[model samples]
Target: MITVERLTKRYGPFTAVDDVSFEVKPGLVTGFLGPNGAGKTTAMRVMAGLTPATSGRATVLGKPYAALPNPGRHVGLLLDASAQHAGRTGREVLTLGAILMGVGKHRVDEMVELVGLTEKEANRRVRNYSLGMRQRLGIAHALLGDPEVLILDEPANGLDPAGIRWMRDLLRGYANEGGTVLLSSHLLNEIERVADEIIVIGHGKIVAQGTKDELLAGAGTYTRSTDDEALMAALAEASIVAQRTPTGGLQVEAEPIAVGRVALAHQIVLTELRGADSRGLEEMFLDLTAGAAREEVAA
Candidate 1:
C-alpha cells in the first residue's frame, strides 16, 4: 500500500503540493487526476523520493521509499519515459535496471515481451524509438523487477487507441493479481474504466478523493418524465428537492427509488431514471475542476 500524509512541497515562494493526503490500497488501481500545474506530478515525485517534501511524509509498504532495499523490486516507477539514456537500447535500459534491482537478466526479456515490444524494437537505440515505443520500454523497465506496486505518470501519453486499451487491460490484470497501482494521466475516460479509487487535485490541494462510485454518487439521480413539471411538484411535496437540468431532465437530490416513488404516486410516466453520474467521468471531472482550468490559462 502507498500512504501520503499531509504532504507538502514548495520551491522558492511557490507551493506545488499542499498538505495532501491519500492512500493507494493493495489490489486496487488509484487514479491521480488534476489539470496542468495542479501538482499531481509533484505529489507523485514525493512518493518516489525524487523530491523532498517541505513537510509531512509519503511511504510505500509502511516505509519511506528511499529506505526500502532494492526499491525498484518493491515499487515500480515510470515518471518520465524520455528520461532514459539516448545512447542505450531499450533492452540495455532494462538490463541495467535489472542489475540495479538484483533481478535476473531473464526477467528483462519477460518484461520486454510483456509490454509488447518485439525483439527487434527492443534492440533498437532509445533515441530511435517513437514516443509510443518509448512508453512501452519504460513500462518494461518498471515491471522488470516484478514489483508489487506501480506508480506511473502519463503512461498513455503517446499510445494509440489500441495501445491504450492494452495498457488499461494490463493495469486491471495487475491490480486483480494484488498489485497496487497509482496512475496519473490526462486520459480521464481510461481512469474511469480502470481505477477503483480516484484522487483529484487542484491548486496543489486534494479537491476530491474516494472510490469511483462514492465520488460519482454525489451527482445524485437524474429523472425525466412525460410531465416534468408535475413530477417536480410531486417531488417537492415529498420533501425531495430537485431541479430541472439543462437537458430537460430532473436532477434530484435523492436516490432513484425515492424519485421513482414520487413519480409513481403522481401517476407520472417516467421516461428516464438513473444516476446523474451516468454522464461519465469527463463531465464530473470538468464540474469538480472547473476553475482550475481557467487558473491554468491565466497563469
Candidate 2:
C-alpha cells in the first residue's frame, strides 16, 4: 500500500502541489488523473522520493520511501519517457539498473521480454527507438527489480490499442498478485476501462476520488425514450426537470424508475430507458478543473 498524507510542494511563489493526499491499495489499479499542470507529476515525483515535498509525507508500505531498505527493490517508478540514457541499448540500460539493485542479468532479459520488446530491439540504442518502444523500455526498467509497487505517469502515451490492452491486462494481473499500481493518464476512456478507483485533481487539490459507480451515482442525467407528448405531460405534472433534445428525444434528470412509473401511468410507449451520462466523468473532471482554472485566472 502507498499512503500520501497532506503531501505539499512549492516552487518560490507558485505551489505545484498543495496538501494532496490519497491512498493506493494493493490488488487494485488506482488512477491518478488531472489536467496539464495539475501537479500529478510533482506528487508522483515526491512519492518516488525523486523530489522532496515541502510539507507532509508519502509512504510506501508504512515507511518513507527513502528510509526503506533498498528502496529500488520495493518501489518501481517510471515517470517520463525521456528519462533514459540515449547512448545505451534498452537491455544494457535495464541490466545496469538491475545490477545496482542486485538484480541479475537474467532477470533483466525477462522484464524486457515481458514488456514485449524483443531481444533484437533491446540490443538497439535507445535513441534509435520509437516513442512507443521507448515507453515500453521505461516500463521494462521499472519492472526490472520486481517491485511490489509500480508508479507510472502516462504509461499509455505512445502505445497502440493492442499494446494498451496488454498493459491493462499486465497491470491487472500485477495487482491481482498483491501489488500496488498507481497510474496517471489523460485518457478518460482508457482510465474508465482499467482503473478500479480514481483520484482526480486540478490546481493542486483533489476534486473527486472514488469508484466510478460512486461518481456516476451523484450525477443527475438519464436517458428515456417514450411517446414524446405523454412523457412531456408526465414530466410537466410531476414538475420533474427534463429537456427535449434536437434529435427528438428527452433527457431526464429524475430517477429512471420514477420516470418509468410515471410513463406507465400516462400510457407512454417506451423504446429506450437507459441512463445517458455519456460525459458524466468528463463533465465531472472539467467541472472540478475549470473551477480551479477560473480561480487561477482571477488571482
Candidate 3:
C-alpha cells in the first residue's frame, strides 16, 4: 500500500503540492489525474523520492522510499520514458539496471519480452525507437525488479489502442496479484477503463478522490432538444440549472425525468437525453481544474 499524509512541496514561494493526502490500497490500480499543472507529477515524485517534500510524509508499505532496502525491488517507477540513454539499446538499459540491482541477465530477457518488445526491437539503440517503443522499453525497465508497487507518470503517452489494451491487462493482472499501482495520465478514457480508484488533483490540492462509481453516482445528464431555447427556458423556469455544452447540448444537473418533464411542458422535441452512462471523469476533471485555475489567477 502507498500512503501520503499531508504531503507538501514548494519552490521558494511557489507551492507545487499542497498538503495532499491519499492512500493507494493493495490489489488496486489507482489512477492519478489532473490538468497540465495540477501537481500530480510533483506528488508522485515525492512518493518516489525523486523530489523532497517540504512537509508531511509519503510512504510505501509503511516506510518512506529512502528507507526501503533495494527500493527498486519494492517499488517500480517509470516517470519518464525518454530519459534513458539514447545511445544504448533497450535491452542494454534493462540489463544495466538489473546488473546494478544484482539481478541476472535472464531477468532482462524476461522483462523485455513481458513488455512486448521482441529481441530484435530491443537490440536497436533507444535513439531509433519511436515514442511508443520508448514507452515499452521504459515499462520493461520498471518491471525488471518485479516490484510490488508501481508509480508511473504518463506511461501510456504514446501507445496505440492495442498497446494501451495490452498495458491495461498487464497492470490489471499485477493488481490482481495483490500489487498496488498508482499511475498518472491525461488519458481519461483509458483511466476510466483500467483504474479501480481515482485521485483528482487541481492546482496544488486534491479536489476529488474515490472509486469511479462513487464519484460518478447521481452524475447529471447530457440533455438536448430540437428547440434549444424553449428547453432552456423550461428548465430555467423549473429552477433546474442547465448549461450549454460546446457540442451544442445541455448539461442538466438533474435526472432524466426532470429534463423530460421540462421538454414535455415546453412541447420541445428531444434529440438527446441520457443519464450518467459516460465515465463522468472528464466533466469532474474539467470542473475541478477550471475552478483551481481561476483561483490561481485570482491569487
Candidate 4:
C-alpha cells in the first residue's frame, strides 16, 4: 500500500504540492488525476523519493521508498517514460534495470515481451523509438523487478486505442493477482474503466478522493421530460435544486424516485430518469477541477 500524509513541496516562492494526503490500498488500481500544473507529478515524485518534501511524509509498504532494500523489487516506478538514455537500446534499458534491481536477466525478456515490443524493436536504439514505443519500453523497465507495487505517470500518453485497452487489462490482471497500482493519466475514460479508486487534485490540493462508486453516488440523478421547463419549475417548487444539462436534460440533485414523484405531481411526462453516473468520469472530473484547468495555446 502507498500512503501520503499531508505532503507538501515548494520551490522558491511557489508551492507545487500542498498538504496533500491520500492512501492507495493493495490489490487495487488508484487513478491520480489533475489538470496541468495541479501537482499530481510533484506528489508522485515525493512518493518515489525523487524530490524531498518541504514537509510531511510519503511511504510505500510502510516505509519511505528510499529506505526499502533493492527498492525496485518492491516498488516499481515509471515517472517519465522518455527519460531513458538515448544511447541505449530498449533491451539495454531493461537489462541495466534488471541488474540494478538484482533481478535475473531472464525477467528482462519476459517484460519486453509482456509490453508487446517486438524483438527487433527492442534491439533498436532508444533514440529511434516513437513515443508509443518509448512508453512500452518504460512499462517493461518498471515491471523488470516484478515489484508488488507500481507507480506510473501518464503511461498511456502515446498509446493507441488497442494499446490502451491492453494496458487496462494488464493493470486489472496485476491488481487481481494482488499488486497495487497508482496510475496518473489524462485519459479519463481509460481511468474510469481501470481504476478502483480515484484521487482528484487541483491547485496542489486533493479536491476529492474515493472509490469510483462512492464518487459517482454524488452525481445525483439525470432526468428528461417532454417539458423540461415544467420539470425544472416543479423540481424548484419541491425545494430540489437542478441544472440543465447540455442535452436539454435536467440534472436533478435528488434521487430518481424523488424526481419521479415531483414530476408525477405536476403531471409531467418523463422520458428518461437515471443516475448521472451514466455521464461518466469526464463530467465529474471537469466539475471538480473547474477553474484549475489550464487552457493550452499553440505558440
Candidate 5:
C-alpha cells in the first residue's frame, strides 16, 4: 500500500535519511524501526507528506500523499499526541477533526468509546487527561477518518500494560481488516509481538527488512548451558562462536541440536540447551546496529 524509492532527506551538509526504500504491504503490520536518530520519524513524515524529502519519492496507492483526494480519508496519522489543545475537551477535539474531515459526528462518538474513553471522560478537558488518556485521544482522532492506511509513531508511548496490549490488538485488527499499517517504534520486543514484517534502519540507512523468519535465518547462532566451563570447552571443540556467562553457563553461537549432540557425545549433562538465537526483536536490533557501529569505528 506504501512504497518509497531511494528516499533521502538532507539537512545542510548532513543526511538524515539516506537512500532508503521499502514497501508496506496491505493486511500486515510493518514495523518501522531504528535507533534514536535513525530518521525513522523523518521518513514517516516524508511518506505522509507532512515533510518534503530532499531526493526520491514516496507514494501511497501509486499517488503522492499530497496529491491524494481527501488525504485525511486515505491516511490516518498519529505522530504527536501532545499536539492537542490543553483547553479543548476530548469530545470537542474529535468533533473538530470530524468537521474538518467532513465525517459524521457518529464516528467521533464511536471512536471515543472504541478507544475506551467513556462519555464523562471524553467530555473532560484535555489538560485533565493523563498522558495515556491523551494518547488514546490521539488514536481516536486518527481513526476519525477511518483511512485505508495508518501511520503511527510510538503509539504505545505512555500507555500502561493493558493499554499497550490494546494498542497491539487495535493495530492488528486494522491490518486483519485489510488496512495497511506502518508504525514506528524503537522498542523491538513490543514490535516483535505484533509486526508481521520489520524494517531495520541505522545511521539513516536500511540495515535489514524482511519477515521474522527470514531475519532469524541469517542471524548468528546462540547456545545456552548451565555449566559454563563445560560449555566453553564444547564450543571450543566445535570452533563455534561462544561466550562464557557469569552464571557458570556457556552461551554459544551454535544450533541447539548441535550443542545437545556434542554434550551427549562428551557425556556432559546440560541443565539447559537452547540456541543462542536472537532473544527478541530488541536483541536483533542491537546486534545489527552494534555491527554498524563497529564498522564505523574501524573506518
Candidate 6:
C-alpha cells in the first residue's frame, strides 16, 4: 500500500535520505530502524507529505501522498504527538481532526474511548495532560479517519509498558484486517514484537530489508562459557564463528543447543546459554552498517 522508490532528501549538501527503495504492503507492519543520525524520520516525513523529497518518490496506492484527494482517509499519521495545540481539549483535538477528515463528530468520542481516554479526561485541556496522555490523544486523532494506511513515527514514545502493549495489539489487529503500516522507532523490542518486516537504514541508505525470520536466520545464539578458549576452539573446529559482544559475551553462529553439545564434547562449561532473539537485531544492524559504505541486503 506504500512504496518508496529511490527516495532521497537532501539538506544543503548533506543527504538525509539516500536512494532508498522499499514497500509496505497490506496486512504487514514494516519497521523502519536506524541510529541517531540515520534518516528514518526524514524518510517518514517525506512519505507523510510533510517534507519534499530531493529526488525519487514515496507513494501511497501508486500516488504521492499530496495527490490523494482525501489523504486523511487514505493515510493516518502521527509524526509528532507534541504537535497538537496545547489549548485544545483532547476531544477537541480529535473533533477537529474528524471535521477536517469529513467524518462524523461522533468519531471523536469513539476514538477517545478507543485510545483509552475517559470522557472527563478527553474534556480536559491538552496542556494539562501528561506526555503519555498526549500520545494517546495523538493516536486517537490518527485513527479518527480510520485510514487504510498508518504512518506512525515513534508512536510508542512516552507510553507506559501497558500502553505500549496496547499499541502493539492495536496495530497488529489493524494489519490483520488488511491495513498497511510503516513506522519508525528506536524501540527495537517493540518493533520486534509487532513488525512483520524490517528495513534497517544507516547513513541515509537501506542496509537491510527482510522478514524478521529471514534477517534473523543468520543471527545465532548469544552464549558465555566458563572455558572461553576451549569453547572458541571447539566452535572453530566445527567451522562456526562466534562474534564477541561488548559485554564480553559470545554470539555463536549456531543455536544454543548446538553450542551446548559442542561445549560438552570439549569439556567446556557454559555460564550463559540463550537464543539470539530480537536482541540480535541490534548486532545485525551494527554489522550491516559497519563501514562508511554499506551493501544492501534484501530477502
Q: Highest lDDT: which candidate?
A: 4
What TM-score number comes out for model 6? 0.85
Identify the superior model by lDDT, candidate 3 or candidate 6. 3
| Per-residue lDDT of candidate 1, residues 50-157 (tens digit) | 889999999999999999998988999999899899999999999999999998999998998898889999899999999999999989888888899999988888
Tell me the spans in candidate 1 whose CA falls farther than 4 Å from its real position. 278-299
Number of residue pairs clashing in candidate 1, backbone atoms closer than 3 angstroms, sequence gap of 3 or more or interchain = 0
Model 4 residue runs over 4 Å out of place are 226-238, 260-270, 277-299
Question: Model 5: runs farther than 4 Å from truth?
Answer: 216-228, 264-267, 275-299
Q: Write the per-residue lDDT of candidate 3 for residues 1-299, one digit (tens) a residue.
A: 99999998887888888999999999999999877677887888889888899999999989999999998888888988989899999989998899877888999989887888888999999999999999998888888888999998888889999998898999999999999999987667778777989898887888889997777755788887888888888899999998888879888888889899888887899989887554366777777756735332211
Give lDDT per model, in order.
0.86, 0.83, 0.85, 0.87, 0.81, 0.84
Candidate 5, overall lDDT?
Answer: 0.81
Taking every candidate in turn, the Cα RMSD to the unseen true structure, in Å, is 2.9, 3.2, 4.5, 3.4, 4.4, 4.8
Preferred candidate (lDDT higher): 4 or 6: 4
Ranking of all predicted structures according to lDDT, beginning with the best and ending with the worst: 4, 1, 3, 6, 2, 5
Tens digits of per-residue lDDT, candidate 6, 1-299, equal 99999998888877889899999999998899876557888888889888899999999978989999889988999888888888989888887788889999888878988998898999999989998998898888888898999998888889888988898899999999999988887656777877989998888888888998877766788888887777888899998888778888787888788898998889888999987876567786666455554322210
Where's the lowest-lDDT run of ten residues in candidate 2?
290-299
Model 5 agreement with the true structure over 202-252: per-residue lDDT tens digits: 878998899866665544345454555676776688776667666556656
lDDT of model number 6: 0.84
